[model samples]
Target: MATTTRERLISLLSDTNEYKSGQKLSEVLGCSRTAVWKHIEELRKEGYIVEAVQKKGYRITTRPNNLIPGEIKHQLDTKKLGHEIHYEESVASTQEIAHQHALKGAPEGSIVIADEQTSGRGRLGRAWHSPKRSGVWMSVILRPNIPPQKAPQLTLLAAVSVVQGIEEVTGVDAQIKWPNDILIDGKKVVGILTELQAEADRVNSVIIGIGINVNTPIEAFPDDIATIATSLKIASGKEVERAYLVRAILEKMEKLYHLYLDHGFAPIKLLWEGSAASLGKRVRVRTITGELYGNAQGITEEGVLLVEDDEGTIHRVYSADIDIPRES
Candidate 1:
């Protein structure tokens, strides 16, 4: 499998021994020396630090040092997610550019990422504070064979993936706040905005915009959000490598998306519940219609939030701003 080959190549390159010859790698990988050479060339095109010499063979020197297109391409070890990544130093919003690209028939695994966004956003058209070099503001163009009604489920799936990815990469226990927020130490570190393109009931593509606070300094946030906003650097007490985190996120999303396609939302819903912070807690949900004060029960099978108010009425909330109520 392509994934297996990629993994094996990474494992081999990670070996601390001196550069292993292509002939040796061919024998070890159980493939032809030409096959090993081809893999090395591919790695080079993707931005790896592969060192090829007449006698020394190929030895990966070091992973790229940035999250730019070249670096992300070089460090990626997955078969999907970012098989083709389009990165920009600045943009209005990746979602906007991704939608345009998807409309023009971009590949399913293509990812549109930006180091900074002039106008990033979240659900309900709220602004997402994404400053330059402080976070990941990116979107993916996915052409899934799913119905439009079930599009909301992808948001939850992404929430789960973001939490898992952040935890795996930064070693911080990030929690989910309902639909699409990854909170670490009770503060939001990640947010997702999922947009879909469909032909009535049929689907065209799903562009999922993700905003992750990576190396944000403590005092970087605005005064209002300073207490509530945080970064992986702050949560982990160390500055994490951005490219590795980006790759981890893409890998996690690709794996979860495959499962979602195989079996509706059941599996992802369970995982979301396990790490969710709002479920089973006293909460107040404010929606456009009105407010629903209740205890947060599990979400509906369709990804709608289920809340039981004080009157025992179960409210199926499609969209709401949820807050964990503080006791007097």
Candidate 2:
């Protein structure tokens, strides 16, 4: 993808601490000085504070916490993921738009990102609370050549990617709550919802919706989730750049995805297990079939949750809401 003028400006500003003169920027970017000045104005409008001096040129004084596409695209190191980004200020759901794009044959790694989601959904139709401009609310499109039955493994793959992204960007330790949730210090920080469009035998596309609580304030959450949900800023005691985290996720996702496609799920499975929060814990899983109480053993080869009950019967859970018991 060709970088935009704004992206080039951001790159130049972020690549160094010294001020970049307008003439130098124009000469390097092959644009007129007026165009460079306009781009700098545009960057200021996007919440970046650029310091301009009489002869010292311009330097980035501060950056916005918002996940503007230009900022994210400029930092992305992936070949395919986030190549085509559809950004929105507010939307009912990124998943809905991503599904529409996927059905219309949107390329793999096309992304639908929003500043806020009015009706964001989590697993089992739970409403995901996404306030305006406080989080990363986006959905990623994937067209892997895998069977429909193996699609659930993609959730694990996404979980690993998100965990890695959070760790790399925030420096806060986080773990995966099996299947799709990411937790920091036992509080949920990220959620992944994977939806597939498929026929009976084959798979067409997979929409992976990833909602991250990056800079959300504690009070922004409802009373019900305030204690359980946390943001990277909350966990790290400092605000994290949303664009940097988003770029990290795409990079990790692309690398892990190629690993899955070439070597298979074994490597991804091991990585997922290493960061899982539910493995070997006593828990209650509420699935569509029924509730199961047992020791969370591990995941099956197909990414199914394996729970060993009291009688030594191992149950393979396809889908469920897990609740790990706490010590009395």
Considering every candidate listed, which one attains the maximal TM-score? Answer: 2
Q: List the candidate 1 regions with Cα displacement exceeding 4 Å.
A: 1-65, 326-328
TM-score of each: 0.82, 0.94
lDDT of 1 at 302: 94
Can you give the lDDT of residue 308 in candidate 1?
A: 92
Give one digit per residue, the lDDT tens place, for model 2 in 181-221.
99987899999999999998888999999999988999899
Q: Which ten residues in a row are the worst by lDDT in model 2? A: 8-17
Candidate 2 regions exceeding 4 Å error are none
lDDT of each structure? 0.84, 0.90
RMSD of candidate 2 to the truth, in angstroms, is 1.7
- Candidate 1 — worst ten consecutive residues by lDDT sum? 1-10
lDDT of 1 at 258: 93
Across residues 142-247, which tens digit of lDDT does each residue of candidate 1 receive?
A: 8899999899899999888888888888778988998788888778899998898998888899999999999999898989999888999998999888878888
